[model samples]
Target: MKMVSYLVRHHLKMELRSLHNVMSLVIFALASTYTALQVLGGKPDPTTWNALAWIILMFTAFNSASRVLPEDLTAVRAYMHWTVPPRVMIIARTLHQSIIMIILSCLLLFALGLFLGSGNMDTLSIFGFLAGMILTAVGLASTLTLLSALSARAGAGYGLTAVLGLPLIIPIVMISTSFGTDLVTGVALGQTVQNLYYLGGLSIAIGIYGYILFPYLWRS
Candidate 1:
């Protein structure tokens, strides 16, 4: 518990020092939202709105979460191996990134609402949208953290991160987007619940995989 707290604090401190990363993500969110508004031309249809919002959030999450593993893999590996258990390290980092992605998700949603105009949504739909974003963020953080480890091992840059991460992320985006679309369109209650269940199941599977597999990657 102490080790986990320490690593989480370390991540927080590092993020504080590097405020530029957060700023960049905000800027990207704004620019992307603005460009989307222009291209999509003033209050897009529900499908377009849902798709665009998810796309922006997806890329933003990718940019921020991909940095879970630093460029200098050897140094990070040595420090972590000497200092903490692999499970502790992975859990801390995943928790940290999950928080960051959730924030980004909120920001993206706010930007979308501002630029795209919240599009005929009611209270329940809004709640559903928020729920979807939270689940998506958790899923992204878990999957990307492990894939970031793999990308680090490959010694490639964000290119490899995208290559390896996108395959995993697409299914998430698909499911989440479908759920969001349903929410926007006022789908049946039973269908919405089913979508939520699928997302929950995927998140649990990814979390279990990361917890089990990250130790081997840490050793490598």
Candidate 2:
């Protein structure tokens, strides 16, 4: 627990030192939303709005996750390999990425609502969409963290993370989009509980795989 916390805090400290990178992500999300508004020439329909929002969020996840492993150089990785358990390292990275994704998701949601307008979303619907976003964030983070490690170990470019991660996250995106669309179109939360469960289950499954697989990847 202490090691995990220290690793998480180390991530936070590094992020704080790289404020411009964080700003770049925020700018990317806001700019994407604004571009959608300009291209559509006004507020889009609920379905269009939901789709655009998810696309931006998905790309943001990819962009942020692309650097997850490369930030640690060969020496840093060697040090960590000796000092930290592989499972602990993966857990920390996933948790850190999850925090980052959650914050970015919220900002993207606010940008979407501001530029494109969230159509017909009531309190329950809003809550459901928020829950879906959170779960999707976790799913993406957990899945991508391990992919980033693999890409690094293979000496592949960050783009490899996208190549490998996109196919895996298709189900996640589908579920989140469906749930978001339903919420945007005024479906009640109770009707969408199944989607939430599916998202949570998928995230847990991916996280477990990453936890189990990272040690082998980390060693080689």
Candidate number with greatest lDDT: 2
Per-residue CA lDDT of candidate 2, range 1-220, in tens?
9999999999888889987877888899999999999999999998898888789989999988876453368888878878899889999999999998999998888888888887668766776787888899999989988888888888887889999989999999999998888788777889878999999999999999889988899884
List residue ranges in candidate 1 displaced over 4 A.
68-72, 188-191
Name every residue pair that clashes in candidate 2: none
Q: Report the C-alpha lDDT of model 1 over 141-203, residue by residue, as the tens digit.
A: 889888877777776866888888888788888899888888778785456878877888898
**lDDT (C-alpha, whole model) for all candidates:** 0.82, 0.87
TM-score of 1: 0.93
In candidate 1, where is summed lDDT lowest over 10 consecutive residues? 64-73
- TM-score per prediction, in order, is 0.93, 0.96
